[model samples]
Target: MYRDGAYVSEHVRPTTHAQIQPNGVDLTLDAIFEPLEPGRITRNDTEIGKRQRVASAELDRKVPETYYLEPGGYVVRYDEVVEIPEGHVGFVYPRSSLMRNGCMLDTAVWDAGYEGRGEGLLEVHHDIELERGARIAQLVFAEADHEGTYEGTYQGENYETPRD
Candidate 1:
């Protein structure tokens, strides 16, 4: 069963009344990063599990209020920090407004007991201007019957971007 807005709000940081939906919480774009080098992934090497190297340049929000994303891929950080509790998992979903603009967000599941200011891959099929702090995605939590909590490489990651 999915958690209601009240329950989800208790676990998310830097939230506003308007940002909380009936079933999920809306997430805003905090920063945008453009890949500076090629990224790689391999299934065989244990050392290469998540060590894929890729340099990136964070776009400056001072120069332009909105970042013009051409037809390409970019990484985005959410303004809010989330902490998924035990026995529950979290999922990020793209906002309909972003989909209407030919943009898609690819995200990973937030395993139980994971906490972070999450990042997601944004694919723009058409040129679009995204304002800083624009709501692009929604985070929803659901119940899960897991014997153990998440203790992966990305646990407690990206904690600095959330507002105070």
Candidate 2:
């Protein structure tokens, strides 16, 4: 079963009225980053390679903000810090508003017991203007049974954000 808005608000921290939806909570964009080089992952290897680091630009939330992307991909950090409840997994879905604007947010399954600020890949198919702190994606939780909690490489990662 999927969690409702009230349950999510009670469990998730740093939530706002505008961020809570009927079924999911909205996540805001804090900063945007571009990859300095190509990235790869090996299926057999459990240990992931070191990520290519590139400086990210902070999104200004005060005014009507816009960031231009030139038909490429970028990584966006969500401002919310989420803590998945026991026996539940989280999923991030791109807001329809973003898709209507010729962009897509690609996200990974947020495993049960994963806790931290999360990131998603924003693929811009055309030049688009994105508002700072805009609700670009929704984080939804669903019930799942797992043998153990997530304790992999990315566990408890990206928890602290200078922007917050």
Candidate 3:
């Protein structure tokens, strides 16, 4: 069975009340990066290419920072940290607003026991301006059976300290 948004909220940090949906919790964009070189993935080894963080324009002190992107691909990091509980797998889906704006967010399965401020590949079909902390994706959890919890290299990624 899939967990409701209220249940999912317990696993995410720094979430506003507006970010909670009926079925999932929304995630906001923290930063964007552009790949500088090609990455590699082998049967036993993998290496991500170097990337440069995209700079956002600060219009005014009262306004939020905004990223003006052309039609292209970029990597986006979520602002909120998430902890996937045991016996449940987390799935992230792009918010409808993104699709309506001609963009798509692709993410990998968040295995059980995974904890991090994760990232996703953003494909923009049209020029778009994204504001920092704008809701971009929604995370939902579904029950699943597994032999053990995740302990891969990506576990606890992008976190300065473990959540209590």
Candidate 4:
């Protein structure tokens, strides 16, 4: 139920662009993601470089903010908590502009009633260079009808990315 300005339709011509675009859209990131020691930029530690296709649990460990992403790379930061209603599915895809720029958006299939901070994964396909805080993807929410929901269902159970 996406509407332009007031009501965004499921599929409609975009008011912002020449072609149709989805409603409730987000922009490129303003800040870049980089590995920092003690969350502070030392300005000398250049060991932290580009990371690609690797899923690391840096979020599990508390580190201070330091450097940002380099060229030919993409980074992710979590936005608000988008709760998929009970009996619905959601998808996240790379923006067309980002695709043209050779940036890859790492997406995930969100199940019904999924909770927690919605962070993203950044990836690069070719050896192209990019900056920090770049537009990567757009999340499209869809509604579904599940009969006898929660009736002996394994879904609906919520768990964090890392559970201790």
Candidate 5:
């Protein structure tokens, strides 16, 4: 049976051109998270541009895709949110097909109650420069019996279901 919210993506089924894959969800090259300066753009020759998160001030910095990921890089977008239940765990992996072709994404993990939006960070492997919004990899959500409390603070808040 289907857990969490039923598969309600633009296209229904396990996998699609832009849908999350069963084994792994595909990552589309689209809008990426912002990583800029706080107030005045910090000046530094070596430090081109990077993202920094501050909890005390609840501030973030975003920049454009100037620096690539090692051999290569990418800015990925998702069609759906990868949600999970409290005390459960999830994993974000690159689609095997994409790996074989070219480009890859960093392995992401979603804990219980991981909610925000279907978005993620991608690390391209090999080399295949493509336009933004291209399908990159796939995300895999598994059912794990991880008993933990979703409290306190972090990135945002772990996505919650069965109550939303």
Candidate 6:
């Protein structure tokens, strides 16, 4: 069975009441990056290619920065850190607003026990401007049986210690 939004919120950090949905929590955009080289995958190893951070523009100092993206592919990092609890698998889906605007986000299955501020591939089919911290995706969890928790290179990625 799928978990409710309130229950899923317990596993995400830096979240607000507004981000909690009926079925999941919304994830905001933290940053964007463009791939500069090709990545490689093999039976024994994998390597992510070089990427450059896409810069966002701020028209007014008081306003949030915005990215003027043309139709293309980019990598978007989520602002919140998530921890998938045991016996649950996490899935990140693009919000409908993105699709209405001609954009799509592709993500991988988040295995049980995965923890990180994860990333997703954003494919833009039309020109669009995205503001930093804009709601871009929803994270939901479903109950599942697993023999073990995830322990991979991406564990604890982009995690920072909280300040006192």
Which should have the higher TM-score, number 2 or number 6?
6
For model 4, how does the per-residue alpha-carbon lDDT over 1-164 read when each residue is reduced to its tens digit?
A: 42331222222122233223434444333233544333333666424344433233344343332222335344564333444556566676777776786657787676656654454556655444333333455656666765543322224222233221
Q: What's the lDDT for all of these models?
A: 0.81, 0.80, 0.92, 0.45, 0.46, 0.92
Q: Is candidate 1 or candidate 6 better by TM-score?
A: 6
After superposition, which runs of candidate 2 have C-alpha atoms over 4 Å from their true positions? Answer: 43-65
Query: In model 1, which residue pairs have backbone atoms overlapping below 3 Å?
Result: none
Give the per-residue Cα lDDT of candidate 1 at 48. 17
- In candidate 1, what residue range of length 10 has the lowest lDDT sum? 48-57
Task: Write candidate 1's Cα lDDT for 17-116 as tens digits.
Answer: 9889999999998778777655555675333122222222255634435677789878888888899999898999999999998999999889998888
Q: Write the per-residue lDDT of candidate 3 for residues 74-148, one digit (tens) a residue.
A: 999898999999999999999999999999999999999999899999999999989889999999999999889
Candidate 6 Cα lDDT to native:
0.92
Cα error of candidate 6 at position 126, Å: 0.4
Better of 1 and 2 by TM-score: 2
Off by over 4 Å in 6: 58-62, 161-164
- Backbone collisions counted per model: 0, 0, 0, 15, 26, 0
Model 4 ranges with Cα > 4 A deviation: 1-24, 27-75, 126-134, 146-164
| lDDT-sorted candidate list, best first | 6, 3, 1, 2, 5, 4
